[model samples]
Target: MTSKIKNNTEKPTSGIRAIAEELGISIATVDRALHDRGRISEKTRARVLQVAEQLNYHPNRAARDLRLNRRFRVSINFPTGIPPFFDALRSGIEEGALPFSSTLDIEFHSYSLPYDHARNSIQSALDASVDGIIAVPPNTFQMAELVRKANMKGIPIVCISTDVPESGRLTAITAYPFNCGAMAAEALFSHMNKRGSVGVLTGNLEYLNHAEKVRGFRTMLSQLSPAFSVAAVIEAHDDPHEAYQGVRRLLQSTPKMAGLYISTANSISALTALREAGRLDSVAVVTTDLIPELVPYLREGIVKATIYQCPETQGSLAIRTLYWYLSEGMRPLHFIGVIPQLIIRSNLDLYISTNKYIAR
Candidate 1:
């Protein structure tokens, strides 16, 4: 038989085909030998194995093993009691995982606690011997340590929505929060003609995403419009009631506040407060997310604009990145930045169904 080998040093595209050509064997025999199928002579199998190794032949390990194994466990950890934005993220991840179900085994863990308790949850996941992990940004030093431990154990990690600094995780699929903040501020000032005093309602500043947005908003506002001043920044801690009360307090204290920039998921509460006070038509409001509760307000002109970060895309990308790292041993990109979308009532229809945040 004519040998299939040609003068090519690159890795072969097909393992069985490469083996057959390398050994002058039939394709059927080569397939049996490569897969350890019965009826192939030991001598022939040995030859095929040697050829496959020399040619750098590889198979889809996950698929190959799925015939025998039931699952390939992947763990997801996130803070509990988060709003619909996170629910959207979970839905995206679950949808992406569907195609890999034959080989992938998924376990989801949710943590609802103070910052320290959240870190402990991550640590527990690390100890659970999962094949890989996807996590929301962690708040405390313990969480960072758990990430380091996971790396040591050779488990890949995907950070979604927010990120932990200096954690050396596999990949972070998120938007540049600070730049988004700056952009939101720019949108607000443009709508208001850079004439009014603005106040900021925000979540906890410790989270990387939140902190970055605040920084970007402040920096951009200072550089672009010196005339428009930020009267106050109130932290709502991602609580709806707190956000509502904070906005109320801010409006009372900063009576000249002609504009409001809410740089967090608590925009729903802020919108409600603005509506109740009947200040929506008077004061310009710009926020983040397309939460279900906020949609009517956007339609009614109670909220002016929002910055949309597609959390679904973030979740899906994070899991896919982790899978790539695990299967191919590829290093993830240093900084994966998802583009932020500017949403106004005019263009809101296109994004209404997505898990993206609407600022309105």
Candidate 2:
């Protein structure tokens, strides 16, 4: 838990001092050891790093840079659909960047329709002269080209929620969606008790994350339950109506679907379709978010479970990590993986209470 040490007394002053005395080195040497500056022996560096991790030494960036008066402007580009997840992620980014209120300026942008939508957003960010860019690219080669141009112009980029690795951005902070798919199957089928085919629903497969989720679900379902197979895969684009139609079509085509797993947040439509088809009580349904629409489903046990990847954590860390890398000369880990959680009907209320959001 390398979270911020909020209280002043809990600061790492004593820990740093102890490391210096224990190593019989000057305070300056210890400082260099901590910050990875100046020429220090590899052995001493390793020893210092080991001690720091053991001590959970997290530098107070705000306190250190307060006198320096460092101010930065960051821009965010996200998708149009799936408000519950992306909105919470934005909230987390705001909370994480709170400490640097005086020193950071953030701008948010969302993309939709038209081929030049992403390009326009990039131009806006550039015109604003932002220090960094955080984006959820729309899984298109054109979006990649725009992001690459931003990187070429020397603006730091951090991809969040969804990844566009082909853009050659700094790094991406998200959960392993493939693992989410496997976990979804485990959660859905284990609860089923009986082995049978299931339907898989999700957003566009152009996203590497979505495609990987499908891959993981297919792989693990076959390995975990040989009797259970995926009967059909549908792209609902996170629209309730589209999901409803997709599920209806699935029912018409795949009669053996005893369970349904939606790997994306757009799901209310599928629930409606199931209810109308009179199979809502018979088939097991699992979704991928805690949206308001799903709350009633969970309460009635219509939707069995949801797999959340902690959007808040992802959003907060993406901003804070990029901020430190830019302002404090800290090199970050390439992949900051957020762990996923599976929520069931019994605990759905608790999850909703803590993560209450206005439904659109």
Candidate 3:
């Protein structure tokens, strides 16, 4: 006996009606089963699912089209100043968006401003009806407020690089700053044998990653070598020139400084200042992020070790997480933590290509 093949390309028109007719069930019962509404038995739902799957039935694409007709736009805001690291991150964002171009639209905004400026920018993006927002850590209060506004407006917010406490953001995608800081501290302490003073350089104190890193470094130093002391925690505001000046000031104040810890993005300046002071060889240096600016220092052994975070992954994950929430109504893993990789001269080649570290 010959059997006729069922056409799988038939479009979904009447959800409850079609299923009801095919399964010989009442429309109300089919509707309840399909939607998991009140009083739907497990057996009925299973049967409905089986029939729907066999028929290749899907939800109304026109309804979905109408719902998403506003265009799925995502806004990515990053601190400006045009750092090479941010450029890498921007490229990562583009790369991440490429695969989703058919589904979502992405817009990137760069601003060189303080906390208030970032707040205003975020508000503007929200006003523009952006479905999602991704940002590096802004000022704590501003970030918290922005996140609050976004949540109130039902827009998903993803934080990259640093986290904002009580921000109520949907997801955070960044390196494990505490673990990286602990590793840097351990490396410095091991090199110094816990006998010398170390100077710490940081960016803004309000940034969660910077603060966590400073705390982790101090904690590990105290635990591993009580004799070792953090000479000073100097704020460079993530400015290269300021970092240079801060290193100079720390060296001037503490002539016995045997190590340096850079907990932010301006490692290049610290290495430069140390080299100028002729202390590069004597002082053990550990810093965060693998930027091209730090490559010469690492290659020349001026910097003993550096921590590497995948900025590209941070950018990509932010977009992916937002899409999951908006498209599938799926929530991300709570407390997502990306591991930090410790980079030394020996294994540095694995992370860098042709002296340039591609953010990935």
Candidate 4:
């Protein structure tokens, strides 16, 4: 875990100029090191940061905010799904950007694949000359090229929700899917009796988050429930209708299926399939996300459990990380994984209302 820097409650005094003077380096070099731009050696960057810390040289941005000369354009692109999940995320980003209103300009961009039929919303962001990006990229090798292009332009990228770790992003802010999947599997296993085949419903493997979740679920099942083998691993493309059909197919093929593990937020459809199959009570099911659609199922004892990845905090941290890097030259950690919450019928109400997914 990356330790957070304590906010110095003392009023801000001094500026980068003071630190530059003491370091005896050109102000431009100091600026590059602070902003993590240009070709500066590790030694100089460390030296500049150390002296800045000694003098408590925090930039006084109130004046800069007034000028509004240095405007930052940030683009947010999320997957196509229920509004509550993405809406909660966007709300946090808007909240984090509130203090920097004068100097920041945000534009929300929509992107989808297989469903929306558009594979290049990210390219559009680049075409529009966005200074930075926050996105949920599909689990595909093609994203590597886009990320490489962005880095070449010095445009920072932060991946949210699902991450493309190999894309060379500034950082990835996520509710760690591997652990989340394992948690969901453990919940499902505990609720199930002795031995029967359990089905794993996943989104497209092209999305890294969905793939990571399946990996975690499978790993946990192997470790915990050796008797319950995964009868089928189906990809639902994260679409509600598609997930419904996929589950129905699983039930048709595997008549003795005892449990279902859904690794994405398409539960409303999958649950419908289960109910239609008349096996809702017979088969134990665990899903992800605490959206409104899934809530009713949990309350009625139809859906056994869900794993909630706090969308608000993920969104808030993505914006804040970029702002600190762009505004204050704070170099964020490459990967910061936030653990997800295991939501059962009893604790469902709290997670739905409070948005609290802190590490236990």
Candidate 5:
């Protein structure tokens, strides 16, 4: 009994603590150096590693697994307006979290178009003390403050679809908005012979994504030809009724308008207005996203093209990024932009069948 007790209390040197003791460093430094995490000095890390190898130390896999067994609560905050696009995002989030369902409890917080609702949802998540957040930042200055609070509280936040660059988000998973807009402009130009005024119907330009698309569309058109000019940048606010009314007024006011670019996923509303105004067949239109509603218009050649901004992929990646960070303490890149794809009538059917959420 005496021999056994002595052996137990001897501090038998084999684990991370032993390495710390041998090097006269803290256990945290030893661990960080061993895992190659955080911002530790390379010289110290090298020393810690050398001592770990010399001692023939190996981490206990069973113990590490046990330590990581605790469940994490992650909040998903997004806006609701375009059902097809936002639904795809939700599906991607769910599918991405499926493999780790046992380890994560995902809470969804969806708000409507005013964007203040989104701000409130994020605040609620903060109050609940969620482990991580995946969100689409509202077009509000308050978003920056929310991001600051989350960062201060040691909660990582990832943005999807759009971004607030100054908000200190962990990462943004989105399409290159500028490129999406430029692609639309090119498509419209091709259909219009680069000599007609194009009307841009979009959401609030205060949002970075919307503004970027407008800027890209305008810039590309300018480069294409001086005769090709932007007639108007109409703000439909992503409202079906407002979009319908807004496009109707534009078509009436600008009878000579040769093209229309629906920069948001408000294509159906705008298209209906155009059809009602007897201008759908006349105006060469470029729309955003490929929803079932837009399929009929595309096949009939009423829409020249639609920019596909992989909303499903954005959702999946956002959750995956947050999960890896929370589980393994890995840092994700600042921005992960999904490349946008242009879909016309020819390629529309292929996307319709394979679109993950659409098929579901």
Candidate 6:
């Protein structure tokens, strides 16, 4: 008998076709079963899915997108400050866009904090006719105007990490700002045994997120125990030197200061002051954000606890919500607030590993 020659030129069957062949059904039936697109008998649909799974088959997302001609451009406007937090947010944005890689073109614009550096970026994206926008909007007249312009142009904009209420954007996604501060207050209250004067080292109140933390901390603390009071609320302007000097003064002047709440990610400055004053053991410190720099302090109990703002979730939700709205006309809630986590020494390892904050 003549040896049969192998057809090396023949290509392997495509995922859908292989599934169809195995299930003894047509490709159209397999497609309908997989996508729930048309009427198909349940038995056939189940058989198609089981065979597809056994064959380790997956559809080519890029091919599907090209066939459907579904593509969109989205612009991301985020701050460049506080690398630990901001970097995590960036990673979240990337993770959120991975599934849509075949069809989504994302343009990331980084800006400095406490300024409206995103004005030009937003304007440029609008000029380019981007499909959607995700931003950390500052409360600036220029930002408001840009947001309004995008709305007029029919481009949906979603704010992350912070909200500009009057900007008239689509919606805002953030870690619950009020609860972030309230959680810190609760931690400090418990750590200090429910009776102590706590000082707040915060960033600028102009940023609504910062102000909300202070407000929530004060509100919760007062309701928890009138005996526990907020001694001083200093706006450090997110400056290391200013935060250090402010904390030093609080350490010197605030008599028997039992607790301190560093309500911004710029907490290393305040923590340094406490360490220098040799009061790290005396004061119950509650800080915001989980950065690599804070891990050592948390382990040593210099930081009694910290509020993790779930920056990744904020980033992912912002992108996903905007994409869904752009592609499928899906509308999310006016405000999506992720619950913040309180990280203490006992659970430090649970959230911290090298530079990454693992979301639980």
The TM-score leader among the candidates is: 2
RMSD of candidates 1 onward, in order: 10.3, 4.1, 9.1, 6.6, 9.9, 8.8
**Residue 117 alpha-carbon offset, candidate 3, angstroms:** 2.1
lDDT of each: 0.74, 0.80, 0.76, 0.79, 0.83, 0.80
TM-score of each: 0.79, 0.87, 0.79, 0.81, 0.82, 0.79
Per-residue alpha-carbon lDDT of model 2 for 240-288, expressed as tens digits? 6788899999998977678999999888888888888999988899889
Ranking 2 against 5 by lDDT, winner = 5
Candidate 2 runs further than 4 Å off: 1-15, 18-24, 113-116, 193-195, 356-360
lDDT of 2 at 221: 88
- lDDT for predicted candidate 6 compared with the true structure: 0.80
List residue ranges in candidate 3 displaced over 4 A: 1-70, 354-360
Q: Taking the tens digit of each residue's C-alpha lDDT, what string does model 1 give over 1-360?
A: 111112123333366776787788788887776656669888987788788778777444456545566445778877764567777787677666554555666677777645556666667777777788888765457667878888888887778878876887887878789888998888887767647688888877667888788888889988887888888888777778888999888888877778898987678778777778877877888888678777787787777788878778787777667765665465779768889888888988888654344433
Q: Which ten residues in a row have the lowest lDDT in candidate 3?
A: 1-10
Inter-residue clash pairs, candidate 3 = none
Per-residue lDDT over 100-123 for candidate 5, one digit per residue giving the tens place of the 0 to 100 score:
565667887778878667778898
- How many steric clashes does model 6 contain? 0
Choose 5 or 6, whichever is better by lDDT: 5
Number of the top lDDT candidate: 5
- Candidate 4 stretches with Cα past 4 Å from truth are 1-68, 115-119, 355-360
Q: Give the Å error, residue 112, model 6.
A: 2.4
Error of 4 at 293 (Å): 1.9
lDDT of 5 at 94: 78
Span of 10 residues, lowest total lDDT, candidate 5: 1-10
